[model samples]
Target: MPVYDQERAGGHPGRPLIQNQTVRIVVIYAIFGLAWIYGSDHIIDLLIDDKGMLLQIAVAKGFVFILCTATLLYILINRLLGQLAAADRGRLENLENLSQKNAQLRLFFESAPASLAMFDRDMRYMEVSRRWLSMYGLGERDIIGLSHYEVFPEIPEYWKECHRRGLAGETLREEAEEFRRADGSLQYVRWEIRPWYQAAGEVGGIVIFTEDITERKRFETALEANERFLRLLTDHLPGLVGYWNGDLTCGFANRPYRDWFGKNNDEIIGSTMRALLGEELFLQNEPHVRAVLAGEPQHFQRTLVKRDGETAYVWSHYIPDLVEGSVHGFYVLVSDVTELKRAETERQRLEHQLQQAQKMESVGRLAGGIAHDFNNLLTVIMGLAQLGMRELGAGHPTLVRLEGIQHAAEKSAALTSQLLGFARKQTIAPRALNLNGAVEEMLKMLKRLVGEDIDLAWNPGRDLWKVCMDPSQLDQILANLCVNARDAITDIGKITIETGNVSFDAEYCNAHFDFVPGEYVLLAVSDDGCGMDRETMAQIFEPFFSTKEIGRGTGLGLATVYGIVKQNNGFINTYSELGEGTTFKIYLPRHTEEGARPLPEAAPAPCHGGSETILLVEDEASILNVAVSLLTLQGYQVLPAAKPGDALELAQQHRDRIDLVITDVVMPDMNGRELVRRLLPFCPKVKCLYMSGYTANVIAHHGVLDQGVNFISKPFTMNDLAAKVRAVLDAKGEAVD
Candidate 1:
C-alpha cells in the first residue's frame, strides 16, 4: 500500500513518471556507487591487514558493491510490479460490473409487455422490445444502433419533436392517439415517452412505451350502440318494463311504466317501490320483491285499481338479476289482462251450463226407464182390483177392500206419471187450450192445496193465445208449483198464477241457453215465499234433487214440471235470489194450426159389452191376461198373442175380420207399428188401438201420435178400458182422434 501511491504518483521512478525519470535514475545510481565504494573500502580495511594486499582488496570491494547494487534494484522492481498488478485487477472488476448491468437493462427492454424502445442521446435505437417491433411491423429487421427518424420516416414531425423533447430530459405521454399504418389502415394507440440517464446523471436516451388499443376502442363503441338499441326496444314494448336495484330502488323505466304508475321516467327513477306504489300496493308486492332479491324469480297476477279510478288486471313477472351467483337487482314486467280474464270467466260459465244440460238429459233418460217398468206393475194391480170390484158388486164385504187397493194403485200410478213427466216421456193427450182457462180450472184446486191462509191468486191475462199442451200437464205444473210455494212459506204468503204471451227471437235464445225462437204463451207462477239462492236454483229441476228434508218432498215436483214443459216442445226459466221471491215462467209454443180441444166434462157412460172381434197383444203375461179377461168380460171375442209374430199369425190364420187390434206399443219380437203394418194386409179394415206402459208410442215418434191411430195409456180400470174400446170401434167417420 505504501509503495502503491509512490509508484503511481511519481514518488518512485521505476516506471519513469516524468521525462526526467532517467536522470533521476542515473543520479541515484551515482550516489549509491559513491556510498558503496567508500563504505565498503573502509570496512574492508578495518577487517583486513597490509598495504601489499590493498590492490586485491580494492578489486574485490568493487565487485562486491556491484553485486549488492544489483540485488537492491531487483527488490525495488518486484515491489513496484506487485502494486501495479493490484491496480489492474480493480479496473477489470469495475468494467465487468458495468458490462453486466448494461446486458440486464437490454434484456429488460427486450421482453417487456409494453412496446418499449431505448435510444441514445442522438435519438438512435439502443434497445427495442419484441412488442415494439411487432407493433410497428418491423420484427424481421435489426434496427439497433439506428436513428429513430430513419426507422420511422412516416411518423409526423410532431412525434419527432416529442422524441427530441424527451431526450432533453422532458417526459411526455399520450393517453390515446390515432395513427395510420404504412398499409393505409387506421389504428388507435396509447404511448408514453421519457428519458433515461447515465451514471454521469446526463440524459442518455429517450425510452418510448406504445400500446395498440384499436380492439378495445371498437368494443367500447359496440357496447354503447347496444345500450341505445336496448332502450329503444324496451320503450316500444306493450308491457310495463323497468329495472330495480337490490334495495328496491328503480334504476330504469320504459315508456309504458309511465302510464302504469302515472309518473314519468324522471320522477320514477331512483324511487323506492313503497314510495311509488303507495302502502297498499307496496305491501302486496313486498313478499315478491324480497324473493326476487334473494335470487328467486317470481310470477303472479293482480287486479289493480289504477289512478284513473278504473280497475285493471295485470300479470306480472319479476326476474332476478344474478351476477356471479349473487342477486344484484331485479327486472319487472307487467301486462294488462282485463279482457282475457273476462273471456275466461265467460268460457267457464258456458262450460258449466253444458255440463248441467248433459247431466239433466241423463237423469231424464234414467227416470223414464224406471217409470216405464213401474207403470206395467201398476197396470196389473189397478186392473185386477177393478175386475174384482165388478165381479163382487158394491154390497159385498170385500168390495171396500178391493176399492182401497184400486185407490192405492191409482196413487202409485200418479207418482209414476210424475216420473214420466220429469223424463219428458209422459203420455200427453195435448189439446189446444187457452192459458187463462187452464189456470182458472186449476185455481180452486190450487187454493185447496195451499190452504186458506196462503192465498192462491189467479192473474189471468185477457184473451191469451192458445197453447197445444196437455191439460193434465198444465194441472201438474200449477199443482206442483203451488204446493212448492205453500211449503216454502213459514207464514201467510200469496201464490200468484199469471197468464201472458211472450215472444223470443233468435238473438234472445242465443243469449239464454235452452230457449228456442218462437212466439209462446207464458204461464208464470210466482210466490212470495222464502226464495232460493242461485246454487239451489241451478239444481232445482234435476230429478231427486230437493232442498226440503227427506220426507217433506219426493223431489220430483219441479223435475216433473220441467219434463212436461220440454215434452210439449217448450222451455222453462226461473228467477230467484236470497231474501227475494221466486218466479217460474213456462213458455209453451203458440198453437197456430188446428188442434183438438179437450173433451167437455160429462158423466161416465154405462159399461156395455162389445161384439167386435179384437186382437190383444201384451208382452207382460199378467197384464196380457188381465187385458184379455177385461175384454172377454165386456163380451168381445179376443185373440191374444204374446209376441208380435203370434199376433201376425193369428191375424193371418183367422179369416174373420179383426174389428179392432189392441196391441202394446213396445214388444219383444217387433214393435206395435210393424205388427200393425204387417197385420193390415190380413185384416185390411182392422181398427188399430195402441196401448203402452211407455208414454211415447212406437207408432208415434216423440209422443206425437201418428195420423189414423188410436192410443190409450196403461194402468186403466175396467170401465176406462171398456169406454175406450167401444169408442174406437164405433168411430165410423175419420180415424179416432
Candidate 2:
C-alpha cells in the first residue's frame, strides 16, 4: 500500500479518534491498578495489629483489587468498543451516501442532452454522456477507465495541447473547427474543454463538451457560394441593373450600373440616389422614383446627357419590388437605343420622300395623258391651217383668218409641249454636255428673258464636269428657272447661275435623302429675290401650282424643270427662307466618257417636195385627213389610214414599194414601232417616221426617240412636216428594214 494509506491505517504515526480512545483506556487501567496496590498495602499496614492478621487483610485486599480491576477494565473496554462501532457505522453510512451520489452523477452524465465527457488528471475517461458516445460511434461499452488518447488515437497535436491546458486548469473553447475522427471521416465541431475541481479545491479532471455543426456549416457555405454566383451573373449582364431600398439608398449595382455612375461597388452601395444622380437628374427622375415606390411599374424612353457629355437615348424599365402590397424597392433595367432612334427617324423621312415622289408621279401621268390627246387635236388643226394657207398662195382673202387659226393652234401646241415637259414624257435626245458650256450658251437669252430689272450672273466652275441631258431640255430648264427668278424679283434682284463638279459619298448621301453616292455636275441657280417660304417651296414643282397672277405665269415652269431633272436621272434641292434669297440646286450625274455631240443646227426653212409613195397612219380621223392632204400638197403619193390596222391593210395591197410610213406612235391595234416592224417584211425599202404628241408607252422610251428611228412631235406645220420628211428621205441611214 502507499505510505499515505499506511499512515491512515495507524501503523507509523499519530493516531486519533478510535485508536486514541483505546490508548486512553489502557493508561487509565495501569494507573488504577498501581494506585490500588499501593493504597491497599498502606492501609493494611496502618490498620492491622498482628502480623498474621495483616497477611489475612492483604489477601482480602488482593481479591478486592482483582474485582475492581476487572470491573474497570470491562467498563473502559465496552465504552471504547461502543465508540469504535459508532465510528464504523458512521463511515459505512458516508460510503453508502457517496456511492449513491456517484451513481446519480453518472446517471446525470449519461442522460445529458449534450455531448459531454469527464476525464481524470491522467486523461482517463471517468464518465461519458450518451450523446458523446453516439456521436463518436462508440456503442455500449465500459470505457470509464479508458485513456482519452487510447479511445480515439487519432486526436491531433493541437487537441492534445488543448487537453493539457485543460488539465492545467485552463478552460479552452473552439467553435466550428475541423475534427477528423478515427474513421477518417470529417466533422465540424464546436467544443469547450475545462478542468473539473475536487471538493478539496484541487483540480480533479477535465470535462469536454462538443457539438457537430457540419450541416449548418454546409448550409452557410452553399448560401455564400450562391450569392457569389448571382453577383457574378448580374455583373456581366449588358443592361444596367441595380437595387434600391425603400429609403432610396442604393443596395446593389451590376457592372454596367456601376460604370454609368463612375463608381465601384464598394463606393456605390449604400449611396443615396440623389447623390449618385446629382440634384438635377434626381429631380428629373423623382416622379418616376415615387411611382415605382408606390408599386407602379414604369417603362419609358428618355434622353440623357452622360457624365462624359455624350447624349444617350435609353429605353428604361422600372419594376417595383413589392412585398405583400407594400413597396420594398425597385429594379432598374436600361438599354441604349440611340442608334435605333436615329434609324427610325431616317426611315420615316425616307417614307415621306417616297410618298411625295409617288404623288408627283401620279400628277405627271395625268398631265402626260392630257397632253397626248391635246397634241392629237392640235396636230390636225395646225396641219389643215398650213395646207389651206399654202394652197391659197400668198395675199388671199381668207389667208389672214387662216393665219390667225394657225397662230392660235401653234400657241395651244406650245402649251401642250410644256405639259409634256412637266409630265416627264417630253421626247428628248441626251448628249454628254458640259454644264458650263450649256449655262454660257443660255446667258444671252436668259438675260433677255429676266429683264433689265434683274442682273443675271453666271459663275461657271473651273473644270466643270459634263452631264448627259437633252440640249433643248437644258434650254427649257434655264429659261423656266430664269423666268421664275425674274418674276420673284419685284424691283431689283440678282440671279446667279453656277456650275460645278461635286462628289458625294455614301455617308453624305445617307443624310441627304435625294442624293446618291457618286460624282455629279451641279447646276445651281440662286436669286436674291422675294424668297419663298417652306410651304411655297414644297409645291413649287407641282404642275399648275403658281405663285404669280393668273395672266402672268404658267405654273408649268418649275414643274417642267423638275420633270426634266427627274427624266435625266438627277435630283433637285431648293433652299429658301421667306425674305431671304432663293437657291435651286440641280445635281445631274457626271458624264464619265467623251465630249458631247454638238447641238444640231436649225432645221431647213422651207419645204422640199417628194414624189415618193407615203403611207400616213394616224389614230384620229382629222389628223389623218390633214396629214394626207399636206403630203399630197407636197406632190407625194399618199396612202392615209386613220387606224393602224387600216394602214397595215393599205401596205399589203399597195403595189409600188412605199417610200415612207408615217404612223401614230400609240394606236389602239398597234404602236408605231410594231407597225413599222410589220411593214418591213413587204416594203423592205420603205423609210419610217414615228409621230406622237407624248410617247409615254409607245415607240419612244421615256419619251426619248430610239437610236436610228425617225420621230416627229405632233402639232406640226406643213413646212415642219415637209422638212422632217425630206430629212428622213435624204438621210444615208436606212430604216429598221
Candidate 3:
C-alpha cells in the first residue's frame, strides 16, 4: 500500500505522457486568465481619457463594458483553475484505487495454496505465482518468460497438446499428467487450464491451476493391480464365476465362465442374460436373481446343456454386489454336480434292493426252523402208523387205512424237507466224490425221470477233480434239472449233461459279484427246449415263484437246487433266451482228496424190538400214546409221560427198572438233554435215545451224543425208530451216574 500510494500521488513516475498532460492543462488555464485581465485594464484606461460631452458618455459606456467584460473573464479564469486542480486530484484518487486492487490481486495469486501460473498465447509463462514456482522447485526469475516445455521437459506430448488447446482459447481439464521435476524425479499432477480474457473479451493468456496427486495416483494404480490379481484367482477356480450389472447384463466374467458357456468374452460381456441362456432359463432364474438384488444370497440347482451337447447339473450361489447400502449387481458362482446326483440316485436303489434281500433272508430262516420242528412230529406219527399196520395182519381192513395215512404223512414230510433245504437249514452229509462218476450213475435215473419222449446225452470229463457234496442233494439238483428240461420241451428235445473242471481267474471274478477266483468242478445241463426270458431268470431262485399253470408244478424245485448249491459254497449260472433253449452251469469248489467208494444200497427190512425198558417222554398226549403203543408193540416196556416232571418222577421210581430213556428234544418244562441229565443220576446205567425235528447241529450241538447215547431224527418210519432204540439199548452202555 505504501509504495502504491507514493506512485499514485505523483502520477505513475515512469509514464512521462501522464505528467506532461497534467503540466500542459495547468499552463494553458493560467495563461488564458492572465491575458484576459491585462487586456481589460488597457481598454478601461482608453475609455476614461476621451472625455468630450457626447464622447465622454460613449466612452463611459465603453469603459463600463470593458470593466464588465474584464470581470467576467477573470471569474471564468478562476473557475477554470479550480476545475483543473479538482481534475488532478480526481485522477490521483483513481490511480490509487486501481493500484490497490492490482496489489491485492498480486498478493492473492502469489500466496495461493495451489500452483497457479499465467501463460501467454504462445504457451510461455508470463507470470508464475510463488506456489507454482515452489512446486517446480524454481524461483520466480527462473520460471517467468520460460516455455512450459522448459519447466517440465518430461511432460507428455498429450499435456503439450492440452496447453496448446488452452492457448487457442479452449479450456483444458485433465485428471492427471506426469511432469519431471528439476531433480529428474517424476511428479503426477491433476490440472485445469482456461484462457484468460481482458475487458475487451480478447484472449490474453491461460490461467492454469494444478494439484500434486502423486499419492492418490499411486493408490489408484495399486487398486487396479489388486483387482487384476483377484480376477486371476477366480479364473482358475473349479466353478464358473461372473458378475452381472443392474440390468442383468454380464459386466464381467472369469475364464471358467467363458469356457463353460462356450462363448467368447466379447460376445458375453455386456450381453443380457436372456440372450445367452434363452428366455426359458432366464425367466426361471428371475426369482433367484431378484433375491440377490434384494441383498440376499441364494443357492439353486439347474440342469443346463453344455456347448458339447451334453446335459449337466449345476449348483449355483448368487450373492449381491452392494455399494452404499444398495445392491448393484450379482456375483454368480456355479459348480457342475451331475455325477453327484447320479451317485445319490444309485445309492438309493441299492439300499432298496438290500432291504428286500434282508427281508427274504429273514423269512427263509424262520420257515426253515418251523419245517425242521414239524418234521419231528411227522416222524413220530409215521412210525406209529407203520407199527400199527405191521401189528395188524395184511388182510385187516385197518392195515389199508394205516398204509394210506403213512403214505400221506410221508409226502407231507418230503415237502417240509424241501422247504428246509431252500432255507439252508437241512443237514448235509458231504463226501468227496468224482462229479463225472456221480453224473454217470445218475444218467439212468435222470432218463427215467425226464421220460422217454426227451433224449438225454452225457458228456463226462475223465480227469475231472473230485468235489465234496451231499449225494442226495446232488441227486435232487439233477432230478430238478431233468424235470425242468422235460417241461420246457413241448415235443422231442435233447438234454445234454456235461461235467468238467473250471478255473476262474481275477478277470472273471471281477465281472461277477460274490465270485471267488478258484478251481471248480463245472456241471452244465443244457436243454434244447423253450428257454426263459431275463425276467424269469432274475427270480428263478425265489420260492413259490413259477411261470407254470396252477397245480402243474411246485416252484420249490429250482429254489431247492439254488439253496443246495449256495450252502455247498458253489455258484449256479443260468443262460437262456426265449425260443433259444437254456443252459444251467453249476460251479462246485474243487476238492484235493481222492474220491470215496459208493455206499451199497440197503433192502427194506421189518421193524425189530428189544427187551429193553424204554422211558418215552413227549409233550403231545396223542403222540405220547401212539409212541408208547408203537414201542410196546416192538417188544420194549414203554414208560410214557406228557410232562417233564412226571418223566423225572417215573425215572426216579424206576431208576433200576428203566434200561433206556427216549425223550423229545423240545419239551415244555425241560428239554430232552436237561431231562436226560436229571434222569442220569437216578438211572446211572440207562442208555439215552434223543429225538428231535430240528436239524442235527441245531438240536444235538453238531450231532454229538453223550456217553451211551444215540440220536434219531424225527419223521422216521416204524423200522427206523425200532432199529435206533434197539441199537442204543443193546450197546455196552457207559455209566451215566
Which candidate number would show the highest lDDT if scored against the true structure? 2
lDDT tens readout by residue for model 2, 656-733: 468888888766676677788888777888888888654222222223347457776544556668888998988876
Query: Clash pairs of candidate 2?
Result: none
- Score every model by TM-score: 0.39, 0.35, 0.35
Q: Over 4 Å off in model 2, which ranges?
A: 1-114, 165-175, 180-185, 192-207, 342-737
Ranked candidates, highest TM-score first = 1, 3, 2
Taking the tens digit of each residue's C-alpha lDDT, what string does model 3 give over 1-737? 11235453555433454455557656755675566556755675665664464466656766776786577667755665666677677757867787887777778787776688887777788667788877777764576788878767778887788877876889878798887776888889988988887556778778899888898899999999999899889888888999999899999889989988778889999999989888988899988988899999999888998878888999999989989999999999999888898889879966975786788688788887888888888889899998998899679989888989899998887778687888888866799888887888888889999889877877787689888988878888999988988899887877878777666655346545677767778887777678788878998887777888899888888989999999999998886666656778888998765564643333334657877788899886765776686688789888888888998899878889998888887665767778878887788777777875432332322233443347764434455677788777667738342
Q: Model 1 TM-score?
A: 0.39
Q: lDDT of all the models against the reference? A: 0.78, 0.79, 0.77
How do the residues 241-265 of candidate 1 rate in per-residue lDDT, one tens digit apiece? 9999988899999988977888887
**Runs with alpha carbons beyond 4 Å of true place in candidate 3:** 1-283, 300-316, 323-328, 333-365, 380-414, 432-462, 475-498, 503-518, 524-563, 571-586, 592-737
What lDDT is reached at residue 434 by model 3? Answer: 89
**Once superposed on the true structure, which residue ranges of model 1 sit more than 4 Å away at CA?**
1-288, 294-296, 299-316, 321-366, 451-453, 484-492, 502-519, 529-555, 576-580, 592-737
List the candidates ranked by lDDT, beginning with the highest: 2, 1, 3
